[model samples]
Target: MSQTESTALADVSALRADLDLVDAEIRALVGRRRELSREIQRIRQASGGTRTDLTREMRVISPYTEAYGRQGTAIAMALLEICRGTGAPPR
Candidate 1:
């Protein structure tokens, strides 16, 4: 193989390693968010409030939409669903 080809392959490998670290960090943050969300749900339920709040969800969705358009909205909604404890769907 040419020297240039070998260097490019090594670069690709390094870049993928970086991507792996980023993926790990993102997973950690998501897990933390889920923990926090569940705790909030518990407190809200204790206070006789619904687990999911549509108005607040919209607020969450808005920044995602502004940052990434349609795809961001989908990402935000998915996160919301994942964080919400198993129960009836929010109205």
Candidate 2:
């Protein structure tokens, strides 16, 4: 390959490595969020509250919505799904 092509390939490889790191961090943060959600569920249950809190959810989504517009809402919803699981009825 030409020198220019080789340099471009190297840059792409480096960017991909950075993306891998970001993905790893996101996964770790999501896992932590799930753990926190479990703890919150425990506390709410002890207080005779429902597992899902719509008000709190809106609060969670608000900042993301402001920062990222419509996509932010989608991101928050995905995070909530990861942390809280789908509201599926048991068989």
Candidate 3:
């Protein structure tokens, strides 16, 4: 019932609101990534080939991961797993 306690609760609520927004954005981006993977699969199928291209995955993920100071290849590998789970063609 203290003012300090109420202030802390308000701050927590604000942080949760921000986090919810971020979660929505993350979900949207993931959906877009899945859509792109489907398009990639279609493109490969039309070219009479199968299997996702690892190099293409690397190319797409590298810059994004690099900005996070992480290994791009590792990020690509993780995405490959996610893509497979979503029914995208395997690399």
- Provide the lDDT at 47 for model 1: 100
Per-residue lDDT of model 2, residues 4-86, tens digit only: 99999999999999999999999888889988997898889899998889999999999999999999999999898877856
Per-candidate TM-score against the hidden true structure: 0.91, 0.89, 0.70
- Give the candidates in order of TM-score, highest first: 1, 2, 3
lDDT of each: 0.90, 0.90, 0.75
Q: Largest TM-score belongs to which candidate?
A: 1
lDDT of 3 by residue, 22-83 (tens): 99998687668777777878888899977577677667777767775567657666766676
Per-residue lDDT of 52 in model 1: 84
Candidate 1 per-residue C-alpha lDDT over 1-91 given as tens digits, one digit per residue, 9 for 90 to 100:
9999999999999999999999999988977998999999999999999998899999989999999999999999988887885645434
lDDT of 3: 0.75
> Which candidate do you rate higher for lDDT, 1 or 2?
1
Query: Residue 47, candidate 1: how far off, in angstroms?
Result: 0.6
State which candidate, 1 or 3, has the greater lDDT.
Answer: 1
